[model samples]
Target: MSDVFEKVMDLAKRRGFIWPTSECYGAVAGFIDYGPLGAMMKRRVENIWRDFYVIQEGCYEIECPTIAQEAVFIASGHVKGFSDKMCQCPHCKEFLRADHVAEAGGIKNPSTMKNEELAAAIASCTCAACEEVLGTVEVFNFNLMFQTTIGPGSQRVGYLRPETAQGMFVDFSRLLRFYRDKLPFGAVQIGKAYRNEISPRQGMIRLREFTQAEAEIFVHPDEKNHHPSFKRYADYTMPLLTYVQQEKCEEAVPMSMQEAVDKGVIANEYLAYYVALTHHLLVTIGIKPGRLRFRQHLPDERAHYATDCWDAEIRSERFGWVETVGLADRTDYDLKAHAQQSGTPMTVFIQYDEPKKVARRRIIPNMSVLGKQYRNKAKAIFEALANATPTAEGADVEADGEKIHIPADLFEVRDEIVDIRGEDIVPHVIEPSYGIDRMCYAVLEQSYDEDTADGEARTVMRFPPNVAPIQVAVFPLMTRDELDTIAHEIARSLHKAGILAEYDDSGAIGRRYRRQDEIGTPFAITVDYDTKDDQTVTIRDRDSMKQVRIAIDKLPSTVCALLDGSLKFTSLES
Candidate 1:
């Protein structure tokens, strides 16, 4: 591991952020335990995300099971699909993802090749892991999803879901009913998705099981061409790495969201609009705005069914531009697939204002003349013309590229007027899928920093106040009788005000402040001796360490304001 990764691991472990799973005996490769502080931070982050995608956007949130049935996967095309080309080491008997190995080794499309082709590619390349001459790497398709049996006897085969998108697709009909059968509404799901990693060694970056926050927005096919809410993010700047830019420019280009949509880089207004919103939300969640960019997937890398796709890539200290979120225009693929498989209609009844009238074409074959000429085949010709609509060949169209010659005993062909009602349509889907675990790590990496002052360096997590694990750290300066009692009382008061206040009296005031700072607690409230007479406590800022004296009665509003960002520590410092 690199020095920075080691530091991150050490800091995370020491500060109750993250740890390996089942360390009592042996640790699991693809599992992690979120410590007390880490759990709070993660929960707060997810809640804030909900505030944006669910509450603000008027979308409903859904929870689904981790293990899905084989039918669900088959319908979603995950059974035959959802695979990565993998090669196993002969000596160590370890499996490896072909794409990762080829990319790190500076090769291209290693997974797309056949077994023989991949075997040839590997002969020229060496394994970074063992440095042992890597054997012939036969490219075998390996499903990333972890398989499990739903019932007791392993009779029913199920697999842990690879993505949360399928859940939203499966529940489309119910969601449509719940939303009063409206188009252009979204269903969001935030939960765990699993992947069985092969030879995992990227720390928390690549995990077998991770959390995902996914949104499936269904809209009419024509509606996707333009979004009414596009103006909301029109002026926002998004650093874009398009296919053309990647090929031509040395770095990503920063432009308004509207410009990208108009220039055809984003494909449409709806895709661009959400890309900008995602950009704004990421910055709000403590991901550094500079290290973030929306990278468009190339034609070869894009999903076969996607109309357009982009990834929110966060530059990690170690991994260099890792994909944290995916925004794709699925365009009625999932629903269509399910409809075909289940033989059930998954459509909303869109009511039109008025019925339409139009001139129609009808083919009426002349059966009177055919009855005298060829009476045997007269019925067949009449049936064929009645069932046939207008084609290039007019009446009695060709079957299998060959004309079925019939006698003229059928009805005649003519145009007739007809009145038409509304038609049913398959709503296209625009999905914004997020890898929540990766975003959590990005927030940590971006907010992490070291400050040096007074001949010593202090490490602090400069997390946003709302998402910080501990909102306040209550401390007694001397751990004295009066100070300690008042401090505990003050902690209780903060807790009642809905703040995550932690009481620390075992160490010096500075040490207590340091501990709080490590976990990204925004404020430190100190109840000193003067509180006994004047009823005042000192409120210290985490970032600046500036202290302010406030009355006990006013402490709640002051701290609450600080937490809500309505009031700032700098404003109250003086």
Candidate 2:
């Protein structure tokens, strides 16, 4: 960790934002507990995300078990491919990611290298902790899933889920039924996901267990270029770093969503719409617009199943640009894989706008000639040929792992026109995956500020009002009964009005305000001697440190309005 990271973490710990878990027993890496303020702030962030995906998008949310059967991951491809390259130090016996070691040694893009290349790079570099001349470096795949047993004696294998996406895929049939087997319906899941990191560093940026908010929007494969609500976000402009620009070492160019889709910069309208929504969400949650951009994933970097993918990267002082969310056009991969593995159809019946006659191929099988050639198997072959589309010359069919070839005289093929109403199709999925822990860290870092107040350096977190840990803080000018009583009353009133408020009366007014400023409390109400007579209190703004006097009855409404940006502190100057 760098000096800036240490400072931010120190303030977080001191102000009840976060703490290392199991500190008394020598805390482990990659894990931390959210303190009182952090927990409340995290809840608010989750709720805000829910508003965007669930309420605004009209998607239903579902809760699933964090642990799943091994078969679930096998179908999702997480069991085999979800791994990282790692090398254990011969001297210290500590395991570390091989790519990270190569990057520290001035090698760029080590993630795309093969295991042998990563091993060779590790051999040239020394241990990061100890400068020991390492022996031969052997890079190997390290699976990141936490394995467990569902029953006694390990009969049923299970694992802690690596993402919430698989849960949505597994519940496809149920969700399809809920949506009445319609296309373009979505399901979202927010829950804990576990990753067994080889070497977890970077505080909150990397974690063994974290929260993920994932939504899978199932749409017709042919309808990706057109959406019902494309106009809603078509005009929104964002900074886009295309794959071509990355190859040329150029910065992101500002472009509107409509232009991006029209020029084929983005894959389709569905992907572009979510990209714009991600920008809106990040900015609304207090991320600086200048420090955020959408970087398109290169063909080599994207998953095999995804046609196009982009990451919403947030700039951090300590860790350069970090990916907080991933939006991908996963076209019919998960659903098809699960259907093949589970033997349950995962498809939506898409009806045509108008029923019409379609050309059909009919196969007529000769049963009498086949009955004498293969007495028992002829029956199965006749049934198989009935459902198969035979050619004019011949056709091949397989049953019970045996290949059976039918002669040209055995079956006749003819084309005919028939009326068809609809057909079943595997819906393509557009996913927006979010790492809540990383987002929380980005919020903290972006909101952090340092300034001099009254000749002393004061640290403050200028978090947005919607996601602030404490919306308002109530303070007493002094620790007197007359002042403390009014402060508590004001706190209660604010709480009743659905505002999170804290009351402080232990120290001087300056110290109380400083404490709230550090935790990003937007508004502070200080009850002084004047309040007992006039029934008015002084409200201080965290960002400006400006104070305003308002009547007691109007305090709740004023604070609420200020938090929502409807009422400004400068408006009360006159």
Candidate 3:
């Protein structure tokens, strides 16, 4: 077992965050139940994500159904291609992730290997389960989607959507019309995504069903370089892992967004802009700077649909530098595929400023004449003509699969005056997808430490205010009625003001503070007898163990300002 992971798991259960599901009957793998604290923490993290990508970024947040029809996956190429290789343990008959097992045994790029090669790799290896030599290992594809029947009959096949971006793709036309035919627009969906792992041995880092916050930004293919808000984050510095740097085995180099794009560490301004945003959001949400890096996805590891992909990987004691977020440039492949399969025009019409007159050859169909000649098929001929490009006709026309033998008497072929106003184009998508479960674990693991305070080793979680499960804990000095009353009142005030505050009075003041600190409450407000005299409370900084006095009336704003970093506890009275 990973020792650090085991420690965090115990801390999570004891502190009211996350625990295995159905513990009474026997715990289940790949499923975890969030406790009161965990649920609150998850919501808080998602809300902050909304602020960054949805609100500040000027995108729409949509809620879509979790169960999608099989056609959706077929159109999105998941039904055919979304698969992971699997191998079973011979002795125990337990299945394991094929590539992971091969890679752990020194096969460099197991994902790119063929089934025969995979089998060969496993043959020379011993199963981790029973240490028995794997014999004639079989490598087979396993679809990771969790399938379900939609209705009464088991006929209709449905699946838990593997991603949130597909809903956005399928809803593109409605959104386009709603936005009044805008060229560049974005849509986001934050919800659950599922992948049935064969074995989820890595604690919270891997889950069968997990929360995913994803953004899909659609733009004209040629216009991806000219992001309007590119300048806002151009100067922001980040740890960039350029493709070239990897070739030299160099460490991730710190550089500005401008340099990252200019140096080709990031593909373009649009991609760089979002990568910078991801970095900012991670840091703002309590991930330490040194523990985070942006790694370029090696070619074999990139999603099949992505042209360029990078991930925001965070370092954890349990899993070293795991991928918590993915930033990918999925160029118009999805839309094109859907458009072709569904027989719907997916391109947006980009209108020109002024209509242009162009001379082009046309099959001038006489409606009155052709209508009489082929009365029923006249409209069909016109449709075929409209869809047929000049080159397709080649001075002859095929109307509705009927070869139209053009004769001078039947129709006239000549250059005609026409107005061309706009052209249709498929919009390319850039996506930033995040895994909330992995990130939550990264936060807990990175912030965890055991420090000796007064000759006692104390475990504490140092979460930042924005994403911390509990922001502050309101503690009364003693269990006396008056102190408890004041503490309860103060806690109520904080709750009303949207602060997560806890009212604890049963334990000693020091013990209470320690308890709150253990769960990563940044500030603790202790109501004492001094509050009765001066009506001022003592606010203690959890990390520094320093205390200051503040008026009771100023508590809300003072705490609010401190939480946002606009004011410091040292500068303020508390």
By summed lDDT, the worst window of 10 consecutive residues in model 1 runs over 392-401
Model 2 agreement with the true structure over 1-574: per-residue lDDT tens digits:
4566788889888888889998899988988999999999898889899999999999899999999999999999988779778898988987877888888888889888898878876787888767785568889888899989997787899999999999899999999999988888999999999999867999999999999999999999999999889999999998899999999999899999999999999999999999999999989899999999999999899986798999999998889999999999999999999999999999888777888799987887777887888788887887788787556668788756689888889878878998788888999999999999888998998888899999999989999998899999998888785788888888998899999899888767798889888899998898989998899989888989999899999998999899887988899877
Candidate 2: segments with Cα more than 4 A from true spot: 84-141, 359-375, 387-417
lDDT string for model 3 (287-307, tens) is 988899999988788887998
Pick by lDDT: which candidate is best?
2
The candidate that wins on TM-score is 3
lDDT, ranked from best to worst: 2, 3, 1
Off by over 4 Å in 3: 1-3, 84-141, 367-405
Given candidate 3, what's the lDDT at residue 514? Answer: 85
In model 3, state the lDDT of residue 385: 57
Give one digit per residue, the lDDT tens place, for model 1 in 64-156. 888889888899988766887777766566677766667776778765677677767776566666666676767778887788887788789
Q: lDDT scores for all predictions?
A: 0.82, 0.90, 0.85
